[model samples]
Target chain A: MTTSREIRLKSRPVGLPQASNFELATVDLPAPGPDEVQVRNLWMSVDPYMRGRMYDRPSYVPPFQLGQALQGGAVGEVVASNDPDFKPGDIVSSMFGWREYYNASPKALAAGGLGAITKLDTHGIPPQAFLGVVGMPGLTAYVGLLRIAALKDGDVVFVSAAAGAVGSVVCQIAKLKGHTVIGSAGGPEKVAFLKSIGVDHVIDYKATPDVVAELAKVAPKGIDVYFENVGGVHLEAAINSARPFARFALCGMISQYNETGKPEGPPNIIQAVGKSLRLEGFIVSNHVDMFPQFAKDMAEWIKAGKITWKETVEEGVERAPDAFVKLFTGENLGKMLVKLA
Target chain B: MTTSREIRLKSRPVGLPQASNFELATVDLPAPGPDEVQVRNLWMSVDPYMRGRMYDRPSYVPPFQLGQALQGGAVGEVVASNDPDFKPGDIVSSMFGWREYYNASPKALAAGGLGAITKLDTHGIPPQAFLGVVGMPGLTAYVGLLRIAALKDGDVVFVSAAAGAVGSVVCQIAKLKGHTVIGSAGGPEKVAFLKSIGVDHVIDYKATPDVVAELAKVAPKGIDVYFENVGGVHLEAAINSARPFARFALCGMISQYNETGKPEGPPNIIQAVGKSLRLEGFIVSNHVDMFPQFAKDMAEWIKAGKITWKETVEEGVERAPDAFVKLFTGENLGKMLVKLA
Candidate 1:
């Protein structure tokens, strides 16, 4: 028997969840049974989507149950394995997060199963990348750009929240594809980070009094594609700067996720008709079929020094809630993660 | 030297356009020059989109100039022709509407040119059908469903403004393709018309207090495709009733067009991400390449009695402004037209 430290949902949040809404719990773990593998989680992800799960409402994914351990993407080492497919010391990724340890049966690791566990090759890259750039966030950027937006060469692409995990990758990928990339971030630091990754133009939304006018000044020809992560004013600005027939890949509306009341939608959505725009909202899990291709491309890009990543990591499982709360405040530079023992 | 009665835009409208904003004028008809044709318009269409043209804003189509004759889809008889391809007494369609007569040069009739004139065979169908069911509105419905929505068999479709020009055709096509169709229109008369056209379910939005709840009760399985014509609450309700991966073909947003201030956007647009919804806004003129195929399919459908059309036509060009204004108040059924002598 072993004791595992896990984060449990104390209650559903009203708005921006406080640390008190979550409780650190000590859970007793049993020995791995037949066809089961015991994992010691090393790194876990804290994403904006987690905010939606905190609410007891229907979303793309199920809401996090009260008094239960929260689940997310995590990379871990198999400490004990009764299954022949997984051996001790093997690195793997699973959807058993916000906890230090977990036991998964083969059924749980099977294709299309809950808590999908996959053995990681690592390939000299950090295992933590599986939680961000080399994993879900990376695949999201790839599918949203190539499949959803149908991004083409010479297309002027605008990415909101360009300092975030998915947006950063989107910026780099569009630039690599010979498209002019415009990135927007909250502060000068994030804006500078965006420029460091070879973004054509970076808008410090914190300093800009009018984002829409600033976008017009920077992209005079109007953007052909908008990678929407931050909605509200960013969405309105993108719509205003969108050329006729522009495509918008709607991944998230992080800006309004924490609002207690119904957030005001972009008032200029009517411009979509006049501009002949296509705005498609998608969940990353729907495009998992592109994982292999995305992994291959991303790996090559990393090796060629064509892609770079940043991580604002909180040390220890106890800080998971703090790390998650920071995402809403735009405190994280890129992928936000919590390291665990 | 015949005289032509033409409707001119006297001034731009501030809110819902008044009849005073338009004026009727008589102009001398010039004889056909080299490679030209003189047409006496028999029928002209006054559509909702013409309102956008009245505003001096850049859109998919150019805005209507003040103190000049308004242009739209019109079918007429070529009284005289200097071009070999077009002969006298031949029925032709042109974008020279709100007028009793027009002279079109070869430059004006050239492929892809503004005010392009095309010879219409009619094929035993009413000549006025060229302005609605067999023309732009028909193609709008076709492209919106097939190409934009990528509709499949067994897909449940919900059409807003379902008794109107494009929506009526959309409902019929979906039903013909063996898909369940839910239609929403204001008033009992329009609702009855939807049922006559074989719509599986009809919602009289005028009587319904909460359209979203009504849609949920009718389409318990949720809709797979939404043909969006009326926006506002209808759009919000459609999004709420949409199943995962649902497609929305945004043909028009007639509800908010005449609003003096910015129209309120659907507050539930966030549902799009969780449902993986795709909302594509399109203008029919961009997909004119599908005309031949649409015309062929539409002709066959009409011949086999698989399709039917209704027109709420106002007689005389003098009432064209009134006919156009009626669209805002939902005063007409199916295709709204102005019959010219």
Candidate 2:
């Protein structure tokens, strides 16, 4: 038997979750059963969407149950294997995060199968890239801009949270596609990071009294596509600056996720009709069919040094909750992750 | 020479427009200039979208300027013609309404041409049918549902303002396409009109205290397509009861158009992310390509008794402003028009 440290939900969060809401518990792990392999988690992802799962309400994914170990995307290595498909030392990705180690079945690893468990082919790139740039975040950016927004050549693209995982990739992709990319970030540091990624215009929203005015100054003709990450003021700004027939891919609304009361939606949503705008909200899992193409393109981009990434990682499983809370506070410049042994 | 009685914008309205905001002016009109025809206005159409044009802000169509003649869809008789293409007694449609007479240039009559003037065949239907069932409002309903919403067979559709010009046609088309249709109207009279037109379920919003709860009770499976006409509470209710991957075609928001201050948007718009909903706003003028097919199909539908329309007409050009205001008050059941001699 082996010991595994895991984070369990102590209770549903009311607003911004407290560290006390999560309980660190140690559990005994037995040897893998038939067709199962034991995985030792190396790195786990902490995303804004996880905050929704902390609530007791229904969402695209099921809410995390109280007193149970929380689940998320994690990169791990097979420490022991009883399954022919997975051998010891093989690196894989799974939805078994918040735990130091767990047993995974091979049947669960198959495409469209049970739990998400796929073997990693790092190709000289770090395995954690599979958790951000070449993973769900990257695919989300690709699908949102190309598919949902129906981006075309010479399109003016505006992305909120542009230094973060998905927005960073979106900015880079739009630039590569010969489109003008405008990005918004919180502070001077993130604004500088966005400029490094080739964003045409970067707005430091924290410094700007009126983001809409700043956006209007940069995009005089107006934006064709808006990648909506931070909602509330960002949404209103985008709406005010959007050109006729503009498409907005509603990716995440991290701004209002922690609000206990119902947050007021964008007051100028009526502009949608006058401007003939399209706003679509989506969950990445529903568009998994595009993952293969996304993975191939992302790997090629990284290999050619056309793509760059950053990760704000906390050491040890005990700091997982801290990493997650930092996402809301805008403390992370890019993908927020927890490193585990 | 002719004396033409026209309505001009006296001032920009603050909330609901009053008679003081409009002026009745008598102007002396010259005979048709070269390549021009003098048209005597017969029937003028007043729609919900006209309210948007009343604002000074830019929209899909240019805002109606103060002290200028208000323009909209109008059908008239060519009283005199200098152009060979048009002759005396020729019935034509023009974008010069709220007036008794106007000089139309032949260059303005071509498809994809400026000024939007077209000769009418009538096809055994009333020429005013070109204004409602077979014209812009009809095409608005057709494109919004089939094109924007991308309605498919077996889908459940919920239409707000189900007894109004566009909404009435939308309900009928959805039913004819083998989809379940739910309709909402203000009064029992309008609610009965919805049932008469074969709507599967009808909600009298005026009678219901909680529209969301009432919608859930009727559409237990939830709606797949939502044709949004009224905004505010209706939009909130639709968002609450929308099924996963639902599409909303925002046609109008007559409810909030008269608000002096910013109206609160749908509080539950966050449900959009979880449900993967798409909300698209559109203008009928932007979709004129579908008019031919729409006109053809709509005429056939009406001829076969598969479709029907009602117009609440107020006699004389003097009642034009009254007809437009009646739209906001829900006094008109279907298409609101003013018959001008």
Candidate 3:
């Protein structure tokens, strides 16, 4: 038997979630049944998107249920297996996060899901990297940039939340493609990180009184592609700074995730008609067909030292809530992870 | 020599345009230059989009200059021609409206413009129809629906300004394509007009206090396509009623055009991320290439009695300012035009 410590939703958050809204609970796990594989989680991810699921509202993904263990992307090792597909010592990834151990049929876990349980071919990369770069987050950046935005040659790219997992990857990819990249993030650390990744211009949104003016100052000619992660002022700024026929990939509006009341949208959205802008929102799961190509490209990039990632780790399952809440508070620099084992 | 009476932009409008912002002036039209044609305007259009030119900001089209005649779509009869491409009494269309008569080179008038001078076939249709249904407004509806919105099978279309030129066409096209269409406009006349055009559902936005709630009440299943001509509450309503992967064709923001100060945008725009919505803005000028296809389809539709139009005409060039101002006050229905010579 294995004793798994998992976080459960104590209550729904009204605005910004607090750690008290979650509770750490212990569960005893039995031996794997027929066709089931037992896993012991090593790392788990906490993303801004998860905040939407906490609302108990209808969305692309189902809302997280109360009194149940919160689920997310997790990389783990097989402890034991009754399924031929998974053997002991094999590394796997699943949606069985916020917990230390789990037992489920491999087929059942793989059913119609982006976070399907599958044995990892790490290829010398860290297993936790699957939780951020080279995994869902990496594919998100790729699809949003190359597909949604339809990035073309000579396009000037702008990304919000530049130091976050997806934004950082977007910055590096656009820079690698020989395009001028402008990045916006909160503080000095994120600004430095963006600069380190060769971002042509960095705007510390926290320091800038008006993001619209700052973006205009940096991109006097205006941007051609916008990767929208942070909404509100960032969205307004993008609309203001966009050149004719600019494309915006609406990845996530992290800034609006915690709002208790309806958030005000970009006031200058009227400019879209005159500017011929296209803003398209997407869920990464819908573009899983691009995973193989994304993985191949990402592998080559990593091998050539063209890619890098950052992680802010919380060392235990109990700290998972803190890790998640930190995302809203801007306490994490890049990917926020819970080291579960 | 011919005498031409034209409306000039005496001053840029601060808010909703007033008669004082425009002035009627007279000029003597000299003989046609080497390649020029002399023409007298028969019917000139006063559209909502013309309001954008009154601002001194850079846009897809140049801003209207102070003391210069305002330009728009006009149908005219050739009085004289210097080029072999045209002859006397031939009906032509040009971007030389708000004036009774003018002389210009056909080459110069057609230079890099959608509002270029071209002889109209009329196809047994009326000359005034060239300023509306078979012209720029009709093409605007065609491109916005088929191209920008990328309408597919079973899309429930929601259009704001449903009684307006572009929107009325959008409603008819969607209905003809076998989709359920919900139209929103102000007053009883527009509601009756929408029903006459076979719109499945109609919401009188002026009578409906909460547009979002009204949309939900009308389209309980949510909408897959939104033809956005009005911004503000209509945008919010569309966002609220959007189904997953809904597409919005941002044609114009008539509601925001007359605002002297910054206007508040849709408060629920952040919902776009979760709904996987796509909002694309377009200018008909940019999609001029589709004119031939649109013309063919429109001719067929008109012949089969599948299409119809309404016009609110003001007599004489002196009433042009009143006609233009009526757009903001929602006094004009469908195509608003001024009858000249």
Best prediction by DockQ:
3
Decide which is better by lDDT, 1 or 2: 1
The residue-by-residue lDDT of candidate 2 on A84-142, one tens digit each, is: 87899999998899999998786756755315678888888788888899988999999
**lDDT per model, in order?**
0.91, 0.90, 0.93
Distance from true position, residue B119, model 2, in Å? 1.5
* Model 1 DockQ vs. reference: 0.73
Cα lDDT over the full model 3: 0.93
- Interface DockQ of candidate 3: 0.89
Q: Which regions of candidate 1 fall more than 4 Å away from where they truly are? A: B106-108
Q: Give a tens-digit lDDT track for model 3, residues B1-341.
A: 88889999999999899899999999998999999999999999989999999999888888999999999989999999998999999999998999999888888766756757899988789999988899999999999999999999999999999999889999999988999999999999999999999999999999988999999999999999999999999999999999999999999999999997779988888887878899999998889999999999999999999999999999999999999999888887889989997
Q: What TM-score fits each model?
A: 0.98, 0.98, 0.99
| Model 1 C-alpha lDDT per residue in residues A236-335, reported as the tens digit of each score | 9999999989999999998889887877777788888778899999888888888889999999999999989999999999999999999999999999
TM-score leader: 3
DockQ list for all candidates = 0.73, 0.82, 0.89
Residue pairs in clash, model 2 = none
Compared with the true structure, model 1 gives a TM-score of 0.98
